[model samples]
Target: MVTIAKANAELWVFPLSGPTGGSGITAVDVIVVDIEDSDGRAGTGFSYVLGGGGATVAAAARDMLERFVAGQETVPPQALWRRLAGSLNRLGRGYGYLAIAAIDVATWDLHAKRLDMPLYSALGGVARTLPVYGSGGFGPTQDPDAAVARSLEYAGMGCTAVKLRVAGAPADLDRIRAVADALPDGVDIMADANEKCDLARAQWLVNALADVNALWLEEPLPAHDTNGFATLAANSPVPIATGEHHQGVVELVPLMQARAVSVVQPDLAMMGGITESLRVAHVAEHYNLVVSPHFLPALFIHVAGAAPSIRWMEDFPLLEPLFDNPVGMDADGNISPPDTPGHGIQWAHGARQEYRIAE
Candidate 1:
């Protein structure tokens, strides 16, 4: 059996061209991990923050590797994950899961590479092509024209659907209307409030989107407000979408049980890793809810293969620009898993030199 020989992690910060709407993401925080087995075979994985706290997450990642993962013999991926999760039992959620996600992903990459299989196939080869939705526009600074222009950009790339942000401003509905009107025939629209709205305003936003026939209203209420979501789900004209900030099944089970949302979005970093995210997808399936994981389409493409519940891949390449060879979109506006042996992400030749955070 291949035993883990060494593990190390680093933090990389890349500035975003602009903010990510209400979240105000001015930069991306990337926590990168590298693991090697006795034979010198290696794998890499990473996690990120949108705006801040990257350094803290990076430190947490280093701590996890040095303390819990360094000497552990390579075991089944799930077994190692449980060890890590159990270690974090006392620390609560949030940071612990985010930190472990990078390491867990790195371990999975090693596992897949050692087995000589593509990561997606190793997970469960459902379909090679995962349908994608254009996921930008509606940032804090975007005006109605900019929002429409962004939607058109995604449509130009052959995406069938696009997501926009709704900042709860009085002008949001009008902005949504203008953007929706600008879309070509057959294109669909989705809106995200980025947790910027309360129940009353969320309800209003949902009501206003009726004229646009939006596919879903995402994160209109804070993720913790299960009751608020239930209320909205019960009466709002649009289907509710949330869970990107969720840690794992603990948070998701309640949301599902409460019938909080029709589409459950699991963020890879926040959910721990692919293993936990798959658990979330299975749980979502049990509740007859659809899985539309937030961002990281490259990684989630494999997830789409394993979990039949996932219907759309979000094409928000926030960290992808740092990769030498990121996933690409097919002419059909779908993404296919790389036949490469692991998760198939590599830093661009100068990425580390360019974006690595100085100590």
Candidate 2:
């Protein structure tokens, strides 16, 4: 008989000194939700620890949370979402989704804590595992030697596949060649343009990399350009993947219908949380599309594991250090959902004071 009382956001900016090939991400804020029930047990939810441009998202979440769930019963995720539909006017879809996401995760955490079960087990406990490709820690157009070394390191770390970032068409080809050449025979090499290319250049990159046996090409064009995306999806020699940045399930309905993307990569934080992601997975399933849950590896992994429709899971072996009990990958290349109760992360051993407050 407890009710929700409060919420907050946290940013974890663990500095990476080595720089590596992973681009400009110096830190990430794992958005944390503070919830006080009538019984006095406080539960926290972790959203995507988005670095770089995600600070705005953290700033925008609190107002929405206060208006929606500060004094309500820790209800079903759907009930929380129902409040969202009505309150979304002040907070637009993207930020609104992030706000809802923090609370949804908190609700799931609260539910699991109440039931004394792990999040995965509550979601239909399956002894399921999936193949994971190496992701993160690579960037757009790095030194040729550095790129090759980086790709090889991931392959050596038991990853079945590795992804690299590509930029302009000329640099794109070189990046593909460097990483592709570095991988072992059976390991697949994938590339993401990170919304860097136009349709024609994207087509060129895909066609040019035909010799590399790349598993997929991700976000060559900006995420919103569905027609351009479809054009690339249809023409690219590589399998086209998109959807990490989209905000709602409605946005995905058209993309699925048009076959604009090869992999549907809805992130848990941005795609309206696990509830909405499940809906998107069904839509992708209906269209014969491959659903790849992007980023926030822990949350997305559960969504992927729970849904029968999903095919591949993105792996970020580099991101393990931030969590006190960060989830790990198994021999089959899949991450085992945390066995502990809830979404499964405790603050790391030396977690920064109150979740990495930035200026």
Candidate 3:
């Protein structure tokens, strides 16, 4: 009879060290959710928007808590997720899904804590290490020499793979080639166009990527461009990757079924938390596609433990500064989930006070 006793949501904004690679994202707006049971146990969860929109997301989170979460029994996390999602049938899935994501994560955390088990274990997974790829070294307009230097730094740190941002320009090919040439043998290179290219440009980039023996080309076209992705993938030399902007399983199915994507990268918040994210991973496994979640390896490490398709985790470091003790890449360029109960993420002391925005 452990019922939910209280729930709260807050908005926090953190400025990036600099504009992010490709997207030029300058800040992140995090909506934090906390849920407590009648027995006084508590759990925490969060979702974020890349540039801005903290207030809207936070408000939606609050409304969800009031309408659907309060006074509910501590049922299974998936059950709560379905209820939350069903409530949004008419409201549409845009910001509502983000709001549901925060609540769903909090529910899972509380459920795992109640069982006195780590999140991965609660999800029927054993702790294991997954390969990590270095990301965020090369921006779209960065100098080739600087990009090569950063790639070398990541390689020196034991990264087996590195990702660079690419524009649809001719010079982009040379930039990727330069980085590839500088890296040691056995290390791999990946490129992200951030949905900046058209069909023809994407086709050109994929062929060039193959010439360099690159691993894959991510988001060469907009996420919804299924026709373009299908067309490009059919003729492209390199594997095509996408899914960060495709929302949930509904949006991802077409891309996967069309064989348009060789790798599926699910964003935790965008997928409405771990439950749905795992669903995406399992579906990818069905299609023999690789599952490389977008950013937050510290969090996705848990998902990787359960989902066999997730072989690589991106080390983007977007939200690491907010956590007191985030997981780090090992000497072998891999990261493992913490054995502690729940997700094992703790906010830095005074982080909430420093970043919280008033309503």
Looking at model 1, report the run of 10 residues with the lowest lDDT sum.
135-144
- lDDT for each residue of candidate 2 in 1-359, tens digit (9 for 90 to 100): 67876666665555555553334665555566667677665667756645455566666567656676778777776677767755776656866687667767777777777777777666664535677777767878577777788777777767788888887558667777877777778888878788888877887888876778788888888889999987877877778888878987888888888878878888777876777887788788888888878765666666665677787777754345666767767765666676677777666666657447664
- Candidate whose TM-score is highest: 3
Q: Which whole-number lDDT from 0 to 100 does residue 208 have in model 1?
A: 88
What digit string (tens of lDDT, one per residue) describes model 3 on residues 17-66?
A: 87887899899999999999999989899999987877998999999899
Please provide TM-scores, in order, for all candidate models, with all chains considered together. Answer: 0.97, 0.89, 0.98
lDDT per residue (tens digit) for residues 167-220 in model 1? 677888777888888999989988888898888988888988877899999999
The lDDT of model 3 is: 0.90
- In candidate 1, how many Å is residue 135 off? 1.4
Clashes of each: 1, 4, 0
| Off by more than 4 A, model 3 | none
Worst 10 residues of 2 by lDDT: 14-23
Pairing residues by index, what is the TM-score of model 1? 0.97
TM-score of 3: 0.98
User: Highest lDDT, which number?
Assistant: 3
Global lDDT of each candidate: 0.86, 0.72, 0.90
